[model samples]
Target: MSRLITIDNGGTLTDVCVIDGQQVAYTKTLTTPHDLSRCLFDGLERVSHEVGDARSLPALLRTTDYIRYSTTQGTNALVQRVGPRLGLLVDDPRILEDLAREEETADLYAALVGSRSAVLDLGVDDETLEGELVTVCNRLAAEGASRFVISVGGPDGAVAERRIRDLLLAIFPRQLLGAVPLLFSNELIGGDDDVRRTWSSLLNAFLHPAMERFLFNAESRLREHRTRNPLLVFRNDGASSRVAKSAAIKTYSSGPRGGVEGTRALARHYGLDEVLMVDVGGTTTDLAMVRDGAVDIDWFGTVAGVTTSLPLARITSHGIGGSSVFHVTDGVLGVGPRSVGAAPGPACFGLGGTQATITDVLLLTGVLDSSTYLGGTFRLDVDRSAAAVRATIADPLGIDLPEALTRMQDTYAARMAEVLRTEAGPATTIAAFGGAGPMSICAAARRAGVPNVVIPRSAAVFSAFGIGFSDIGQTYRTAAGDRPDDAAVTAAIEELLAHAERDMFAENIAIADCELTWAVVDAAGATTPLGGRDDAARALKAGGRVQLQVVAVLPHPRLEDPVAISHTAFESSGTRAVADATGTRSEVPVVDLARQEHGAEGHGPLVVEGPFFTMFVPDGWTVAVSGSGDLLLTDIPGSSKEND
Candidate 1:
């Protein structure tokens, strides 16, 4: 019944959302990538100030019942290739052969494990095997393996991996200085697939150190303030648990997953069947689908080209957003996979950045208001944006400033549209959120042939809002095998539930008070909810192929019914000069949502400026305000889509 705090820690910005009774307040802080905890508390302090009663950090934390956090640290690590180098030991060389066949896997294998791999002769005696294992492992350590993975490819390969792990531990004791930690594939997943299990282990080992360092540091600092609840980490599996109970690999892309969770809830509320989520932030544009008001879980998800036996949400990330660098090399224009991140941000931020990003170009083209942007707490530098654009874009392309800006706008829209088209379907509606999502979504949607776009009033920090009411829970799963034996299935359920109970106990949740939902997932990713365990087990006995998944949740505070839809509309407050592609300027209506009522509707050539973002509705698109204060823009068929 206490207040809740939810955070989405992104590469460029960290969002904080605080919910109390019927009121919600949120704020954003530039992420301190050098020290993540800095931005965390910075955001907390800023949002705390935004609260009416809770005007300080201590007061906010003292009254906070739950603190849920999701971060992009693991995703950035993989994309930046910054992690511990791993040494792999496999009994069969065919495992590596099978993995190296795929081009992506080969490149990933080369980057993470590389030549620091060894194949052992399992036929040897214990003494011979121990000697070889010690020698090979030590050699790998010499070759720069801060961590080691042991995997054996067979039905009883897990047992084999354990045997090798024991032998290696004795040779290289953990207490010794610089003794690399050993991780086994069986410990990370329950699957029988050798390659997936190995990759899963490898990914976890690579991400574990960085996650552990920052999360623990953040939690310890909060504890110093005598905070009430322990910090909870929101996982990619749509559940949250304490940092100690979390896996590093599961934290991958967790920030974006928060956005998808929000999008799914919005879709269900609107009764939208198929919706595309475009969560554009300063660092990346994360894309996902909410089909039938539910986001599909990828039982066998692929992370950065390496297939892992992890149940991940079906989402993809493209490195394009507000501060994404522009490339005009060889007269070919392109956006980014590389971002300016939080420190330097865009050149318009007056942070000494040389890169020209979408943010700068949009400002130059008259869509974003420099003075009133970002709540007007800090005014953007128009001169800097123009200079950066001219130097990086116009000079390189040998074109005038106006022509370069137009080209940048057109190219970014085309690329964004192309990305959306890849996930296109009939009746597909677009839900755009985040700081930069609404900026180009109308154009992108029109170009991609998507009919309508929805922008939440809380779009700027919607991800943090989505995770605001997340319950503290963890999922326990185990492979039940092809043929479901009632006894076997029951035993698996009991074991997994027992494990879940143990984990929940640490969070001060009683198993009896927690809700337990059961389901069975097959190798091919078909899931069936269990009505009654025994009856369903009997029914599935013939069909056989299934694994038991049980989730234990301790329900947390949630918002009651939100504001109902309103049919009210308001007129634009004023007009601003906006530019077209051909360098012609025209006056555009400006609607300030803060000073006006919700449910305001109008046609294109108008700017809706909020505290955190600026959205432009071009000609051909009709914008309406829903009762819930969200912007619903429907594209008129045969309207000008390219000039938006």
Candidate 2:
């Protein structure tokens, strides 16, 4: 129980970071989508070897204090619309109309439910209704519905829902093999809003099977390795909880939430007021904002454009990234909302991929080296990348390979630049992270009119590293009806605290170590401070619905403050005439960061290469070292060039 391990499992890559006090050891592994646990240990084994003492897997696990994980698999699955076939069962038609009111919601409903839906009339007799339920269930089963959502609306909806549940249970018992999972909206949330609760249940049920399968499997494997601490899942609420206590809906975009935490950390470190973080992963480029030194949050979480009842950090995940498929639509190049995840990855991976991606473009354009990619663990094939570009991009566009390559790079950077332009302002400092984040960030930042750039020394694994700041915690909420007296509110708070105590006790955490904070939240999302019973009564006496929310936290070790360090080295490994996203050619020197001192500062016309990432600083920018050992890229006053 000496090291704290955090793993950020992404669509294409899995990053593992081990923090033992101030000493950090990290590594990356290509995500194996077929068996997630395989990549989980692949990264763990590599990082264990990288540890200072070179502990073995069993030894590292025995001495690990906590293992926290965040993943983008659920986000990718939702984006691709891959999951169990759902058949929605509703008593009222209004629930369906409200869910599919928007065009986006309509598409989601169509994909998740399609025509395999049924509405039951609860006004009929139980015997007749039971027959109707059987017919609807058989029809839905014949229509290829493997999962079901049972939702009801109006004042007596809960009672109707329960009746339907009892009938379904009698019809289909859990003892049977391969029983269809039925999710009820009322069980998921007690909110008055019908649409939000239904959407939340739909998403949770859709994401549950895969999350439970992979997370529990991984945890089981860790136990086989004899690890002492249980795996903690990093949630979108900026905290960690045991896998059993975590909800699938809360895991949506959780990986990006870690990036938001890192952005907040960097912003506070430099005293910056506005920060824009671009986490360029394999399948998505997630954009998060830190305004006035705080990460933005959405109380009503939106996943894949549909609003959910849970609260989540507001991170815009645009489906354009290193592995996003590039296509020619109506003779114009367009990037994606689709990606070739890790299985067949980029064409440069030489893994039987034929589609053109930004990774292929970067490889052909010399931004990513064949011999130095992925810490030199894997080699990229330039010929394969070229063939993919020519077949998928160049020939279709009726252009030469060079021009096609330039156009592809231009389009990729342009799309990212457009996103940055919308999120950035004069005071914004761009934080570039992820394996592919720094590839074209300089050009993208230049296009978006941002001058200062920050590349955290651990940028490639920054999300995993950021999970170190989260404490083991969870939030509990209960609706207290339309309006209530002090006793009702008191009972609600007591019930919530009792639930929190049981959850914390399961983690072997004492009640004394866990700090509890409670508040009264009104129907409209307004919060009243929890001081005494009088406060809750007065706040609710005005006659409106209210809920009692309590958050429990067990503090963890925080990141030690950055210390001052002087320049140690000014050396170059090699030189190459490289063309960047800005379409400029220069003789750039490549320097290995690992070979330099802890806080090495330099000026460009150079490429700073680390084990897991590489940053190309153009001639006009100066790369300096922050006290935290992170790279700070600032433009030289008179040397900034305007885009041609």
Model 1 agreement with the true structure over 1-644: per-residue lDDT tens digits: 56889999987678898877536788988888899999999999988989886478998898887899999898889888899999998988988887678888898888899999999999898789999987897799899999988887765565577688777667665685246777878766754477888888888999998789999999999999888878999988778888998989989878778888888877876778998889887777888998997786787888887778887888877878877888887888888878887568889889888888988888888888888888787778889999998888899899999999888888888888888887865489899998899888888887788878999878899888888645676765455545656776676556666877788888877777777666666666556777655644554455443344434543333433434435455577889898886878899899886665555567887899875888998888887766556787898888665644
Poorly placed runs, candidate 2 (over 4 Å): 76-93, 101-107, 110-187, 324-367, 382-412, 520-534, 543-560, 563-569, 580-586
List TM-scores for all candidates, in order: 0.87, 0.84
- Candidate 2's displacement at residue 409, Å, is 5.0
Highest lDDT against the true fold, candidate? 1
Each model's lDDT: 0.80, 0.78
Over the stretch 1-644, how does candidate 2's per-residue lDDT look in tens digits? 25788989987678899887667789888789899999999999888898867689888988887899998777778888889888889887888888889999999989888888888898999889989988998899889988888888654455578898888777765664137778877656644577887888888888887788899989998988888778999988888888988878878878878888888878887778988889988777888899887777676878888888777777877888778999998888988868887768888898898888987887776667788887787899999889988998889999888888888877887888888887886568999998788877887787677889988878888888888777788765555445656676566556656777887888878766766554666555545557754555455454433444334443343444654545655577887667754555666788887666555668766877876887677668777666555777887767856472
